[model samples]
Target: MNSSLLKNIKTLFKDTFSAEPVIIASPGRINIIGEHTDYNEGFVLPAAIDKGIIAAIGKSEGPDCTAIAIDLKESYRFSLKEVVPVKNGGWRNYVLGVVAEIRNCGKEPGNFSLVFGGDIPSGSGLSSSAALENSLVFGLNELFDLGLSRQEMILISQKAEHHFVGVKCGIMDQFASMFGQKDKALLLDCRDLSSEAFPIDFGDYEILLINSNVKHQLNDSAYNERRAVCEKVAAILNKEALRDVTHEDLLAIEDRISQANLQKCSYVIEENERVLKAVEAIRNNDIKTLGELLFASHHGMQHLYKITCEELDFLVEKARENPYVAGARMMGGGFGGCTINLVKKDKLESYKKLISESYKQQFRKECSFYHVHLSDGTHMIQTTE
Candidate 1:
């Protein structure tokens, strides 16, 4: 947690409730590659970053829970007796769903009051929602002596997003937030929910995220449609999921599946293979190969999956022009978000300047940039005394 942010929330808690609250910092996440593959039960490479949500929480003396969302400046109250999900709860649903899932785990955290906020840029595709959900569960688990293991907490957090918040997101975000270790990236097998940590060593280079700042409302419905299309292709190929379909298999069945469906399923198949290749490239210290895979991944999303927007494409092309930029590609669930890039440390400043200038020239709006490093996942810490 940022010292200032902690002090603020802590001060708010003490002033409002006349008690000290346990502080929690739950980090948002970034996926290097493997976009749109999580729900399809494939591989993903992600890591938790320093940017995230922090909270000051304490149980009330009674059964009524209250929360203060400092960022939104919204305060909410509810009875623990009626911890069920509420449809119109808006952002509160993320918290209430965690409570509901915890109850299903046979542990109710009792009544609580919390003051929370974070520096994670919302809707930048850094998994801020997951960070918020994880922070609530982690704080509550600690507050009530729930004894929830990291893995169990991860599942509960995911269930919160799915069952309560009503966004059927995959497990990658919560897992990355709770299990990430500093200076390492997780190669997660979504099919089995297993992950392996690979050291993150971008020697003489840095990973930068350039935000487009444009989000289309079409993202949610488009996401569901793409998932359904993948499922349809998998059924036609007599596979459990699209992950089981190989490039050759996809080619053979091209005549059977429609052109559009062929495009979507093929992107998943190729993208999954590319994720493994990127893993291998990391192992071999083959930055060039890794860069190639990044570009290929972008092409798949643009030409095949059809997700990239013009702003994202322009920023990537600018990166491609620079010799020191090893790779750059659109990150997250596309339509609009950030492009993760590998820039030579010495050239990082110049790279940013060039991209920013041209991006402003083309889009007539300033794009945002984030410099993030991997950090340890969700865990409670003592607030500064």
Candidate 2:
């Protein structure tokens, strides 16, 4: 736990509401091998990480709710009976969405004062939005005794994003953040939300991310388009989803779709297989084999999915040259984002310096890096005064 963050939230709560507060920690997540497979109802390998969002919340005595975003230093006030998302999809939209979904689910939570913040890097492909949504819902569920199950909370969080935040996201982020276990990666079957824990042991290597910070204007539209293309192929093949379509099935219906859509469909099918392979390799401690799969996934994303940006491509190409780097690939919805890398412990510094210099020399913008580890999912802490 982040003691300073906890103290800060508690202080904010006390200073604002002059009362005790309940605290909860909701962690961000990283997909080890799966990329963009959730929407297709395929398999994904995700784990909750140590970096995450934390909330300190307390019920007020009125019908109005107030929230302070500790990091943004902004205040949001709204009525519990009239919660609405902010215009322009700001951060408050996430909170408002959660509140709306909770109410929609027949939970009439009273007015509350919430102070929330997180250490998860924004736009670093760490699912910070999910962290925030999960934290709020978890805190509210505990604070109000909503009597919602874990799975119910997960659905509410996902709906909050879709209906409130305007992002048609799959359930991977919420599910991972809610159910993640320490030192383990989840092989989630997105079709049915079933998962199995796979143990991870990097031995001499560590997981690090290199953020490109180059979100393009086409990110949203491109993502929706890619998703539509995949769905179209599935419909043409007369399958429920891409998960139901196999490699051979995709080929049988290749001429029915465009060449571009064919490439996209192929990537999803193969990436699903790669995720399962990655899990098997984890069971056998085949780190090198996992690295090779990572590289292959990156190739498919860059060429087939057409999601990666030049900065991401550059980072992967440069990272691949280092013998210490076992695996590297562009993460998140792509266009421009971070590349998750696995580096030998001893070569961590050199790898960072080399990637930093190469990235700067090319893009003229410094790249950011975050070293993360697998961690427990969302849970509350009883703070002892």
Q: What is the C-alpha lDDT of each candidate?
A: 0.87, 0.88
TM-score for candidate 2? 0.96
What is the per-residue lDDT of model 2 for residues 4-88, given as tens digits with 9 covering 90 to 100?
9889989889988999988989999999988889989999999999999989989899668898999989998888767877787
Candidate maximizing lDDT? 2
Where does candidate 1 have its weakest 10-residue lDDT segment? 215-224
TM-score of each: 0.95, 0.96
Model 2 residue 49 lDDT? 94
